[model samples]
Target: MKSLIVVDCQYDFIDGTLACENAENAVNSIIKYINSNDIKVHYSKDWHSIHNGSFKDNGGVWPVHCVQGERGARLHEDFYKHVEKDVKRPKEDNVFYKGIDDEVEEYSAYNAENSQKLSLKDALEDEVIVAGIASEYCVRETVLELLEAGHMVEILKDGLGYVDSEDHLKNLQDLMERGVRII
Candidate 1:
């Protein structure tokens, strides 16, 4: 079945802990797209612990955000409304929780340290449309991972944004050369 891979649309990536200006509108658009389509929606979340390396104590690239069971870790209330209550996730819509281990950093949903990784290659039976936050960082990394895993990746440019537009575009161009379709 066709899959919609939503990377880190959590509150932290929007306007919570580590909100990026570029990711705000894109996340809203991505949610709309998923709600409008029949394709299965999959999301990668950074559910970190207080002891995570990304914290102030441990040296890392970013500050701590999505801690498991915390308010920051919860999906945006607007997006969560779209998810069916009766439908248990991972069954109808797979959710890959990243950074659960707190030590190893996982950018791609297909790979995680604590939780089971979602096989982007094996799980996708049809077209895979990707959308979400921080185009220069997590978004870029996940897209490349999907491409490397041999799955066709269609990036929703309109539904996504970046911190560094120039750098993000360069990465996008490089991926395009490698066969990732941008839409």
Candidate 2:
């Protein structure tokens, strides 16, 4: 079975704090892809608490964003709408929330879990396609984790957002060299 992993397509990474370049376009492309595909879809979100170590307020490098229950933590409106409209979609049950622990700066969705306590790694199939925000960070880390776990991973090239275009391209190249297929 092949699975689609939508990584961190949240408001904070789009238009709020830590917004990335081309995030809007990436999100639109992701929505289109989801609408066009019949594959199983999973979403990863940064559901951080106020005390999450990744926040600047907590002595981390990033500004406070994606705090649980906050607007910035919510998925893109259009994406969420599509998820709601599609009965075939598993809705929030397929959402994997990472960065929930206050002390950890979790970047990989592989470390996330759904409300039912199912980890994304456990829920994923052998073949996975990944798309979404901050290509140099969360998306890249997740792809690496997936690869390390022996899954056949594909990256949606046009469906990626990033903080730096050069870094994004470099990461793509590095990932490709590591056997990740960029599509």
Best by TM-score: 2
Measured with C-alpha atoms, the lDDT of residue 94 in candidate 2 is: 91
Model 1: per-residue lDDT, tens digit, 22-129?
Answer: 776786687667666677777677878888987766788777788888887776665666544323233323666777777787777666422444454455645678
Residue pairs in clash, model 1: none
lDDT (10s digit) by residue, model 2, range 1-183? 579998898899999999999999998888787777777889999998898887788799999999999999988887756654464254667989999888887899997999999999998889999999989999999999999899999999989999999999999999999999998
- TM-score per prediction, in order, is 0.83, 0.95
Candidate 1 global CA lDDT score: 0.71
Runs with alpha carbons beyond 4 Å of true place in candidate 2: 83-90
The Cα error of candidate 1 at residue 80, in Å, is 2.3
- Model 1 weakest lDDT span, ten residues long: 84-93
- Model 1 segments beyond 4 Å from truth? 82-93, 112-122
Tell me the deviation in Å of residue 166 in model 2: 0.6
Residue 43 miss distance in model 1 (angstroms): 1.1
